[model samples]
Target: MIVLPRAMMPIIVACWLYYLLGVVVVGQYEWQTRDAFDEIRMRMDKVNDDNCQIQHLGDLYLPEDAVSHLPDIKDININPVFPNRTALLHLHNMALSRSFFWSYILQSRFIRPAINDTYDPGMMYYFLSTVADVSSNPYINASAIYFSSNMSYSPSYRGFFNKTFPRFAPRTFRADDFNDPIHLERISTRNTFTVQDLGAFPTTRLSDDYTTDFYRINEWYKKWLPDNVDKRHDTKTTYQIEIRYANNTNETFTFHGPPGADEYPGPVKWTRPYFDCGRSNRWIVAAVSPVADIYPRHTGFRHIEYPTYTAVSVMEMDFDRIDINQCPKGKGNSGPNRFANSARCKTDTTEVYI
Candidate 1:
């Protein structure tokens, strides 16, 4: 190469140095921006658990004489032989979508006026009363009323109930129930209800033989390990439900049964004709362990900081147990569909009039 003059050499060197510095500075800036974005994402995730609105309808209409305690109903001694595991898996997915979000979003907003205007509250109440009549868990039956009311009023996003409640009416409710029916319907109708693929997390094994009753189990657990019982051991198992929106906003929700203190607290009793063992029934009851370390798949995210999870404890009753007499007779088969083939009542010969 031809030798450059002293003055030209200095200029060339300076140009090269500037280019190198530019690359380094840009690289550093990009990395910091990415890190900042990730940190904000992690902090936003923590709100996901709190942002969720899961309403618990507990013991709203159960007669004092009925199975009032959580232990009594939980101790029904019925081994759920998942007959059609496929169906249950499907039902679980359906319930996750319909009962939780879909109904809340669609029917609560766009369809609320139609439901309220066309159907009398008494009719809805009658249907709910019928459900309570045959359900083994009165809490579940009564809770349906709350669901109905929510679907009727179409509360805004600010007015939604964020915490668990035994009972609530339109007049008295939380701020989260803001009346954003349009937005709610948009999210609910578009979101797909499917099992999320969380990478991996720590898992705690559950005892095959364990008490379902909260009080007795807590007492026994406390006594069983008097020295130092790990809090994780007392924690309920939870599932990570990841919902990816069209806008590329992803939210992961943690769903678990009631804690040891709530009534009917435990893994939902799976029964035949309901939950069958198969790929559909892949989701098992959460083991007693803290949510953070339980689902390895979700916890395995190395790049993104995961959010703190929560427990959604609601009393679920077998729809099949509802008595047909309590149901109203309607013009079509749509009204008061009874659970005639439920395993709980196999021998009942009661004729369904509706």
Candidate 2:
């Protein structure tokens, strides 16, 4: 049996009591923390389950037993961040308007004859100038605006002359037969002509000026190209001539056949995006339409004649210029837009709706 002093005994008891109180408090705190964490986990699981249910409902079919059903929800919530709609609208309108212009030219009496190689240079110049004056839309500063017509002649006629009466050939000086038998014989003897037999001959003639700049394009090409070195092609004189406004001036340009040249037989054709290294020196797209007769001719028989194509007109525009100021300024993909701003709305140029 050991006895302690009264003062020491009290101090030792006090120390033991302090230790017990600390253990109880710390255990209580730890238990509370664990309980709070479990509660948070349970809430998160409920939220996940609710989200799954909502997604599953989206894939379910409507109830057949319902008396009346609401119409489908078609209200699209397009935010202002979208700009593709705006850009697409602009492109579509531009293409549509250009189609109308080319269609009008092909339908005109003078222009159709011009394509067939019957018009005089003076008349062609006048026609080209008139078209250029109205070709530019007031809203866009087009990098280049041009029109091209090709004169394709084969001595064999490729069944074209066979379709017409024999009397129609010698009696009438058709577009293909400009100066009668002499011209026909001359063209038949050779594969190609160094000079243009027609007024708008692409190898030589321009809108108001003529040049030998594109003389290399005069040779026979299996395909249409200005500088086609591979001359081992069939016999066909397909040359394209242009009346153009580019480099702040009126001039004539020529091309054998670029990417979209042959597609004019169908509806208005738009070329894929391309880089114009020779002339425009920028990314561009071309719209081409063929010069075709609008009215059918009476063949004196029961059969009706359909429209025939002569030449193709082309319009080149800057790709960036077409898009203009339609895109949004933010970081994420701008989804769509409802309205497109035209030249009339934002530019000082003339107002023409697409």
Which candidate should be chosen as best, given lDDT against the real structure? Answer: 2
Number of clashing residue pairs, candidate 2: 3
lDDT of 1 at 221: 21
Error of 2 at 170 (Å): 31
lDDT (C-alpha) at residue 172 in model 1: 9
Positional deviation of residue 120's Cα in model 1 after best superposition, in angstroms: 23
Candidate 1 on 197-316: residue-level lDDT in tens? Answer: 111112231221111222111221221111222434434333445768899988765544222323343323222111101112211121121111111111234333221222111122
Model 2, span 1-354: residue lDDT tens: 999988898899999999999898787643333332243234334433224223232121111111011111121133342243333333334443443443334333233323333322232342443244224342221211222222222222322322321111000000222445667554532121121122333333442221122322111110122222233432222234455456765534322222232332323444443443322234444443333332222223323433333334344445444432322323442222211121123334687899
Q: What 10-residue stretch in candidate 1 is worst by lDDT? A: 282-291
Residue 63 CA displacement from its true place in model 2, Å:
47
TM-score of 2: 0.28
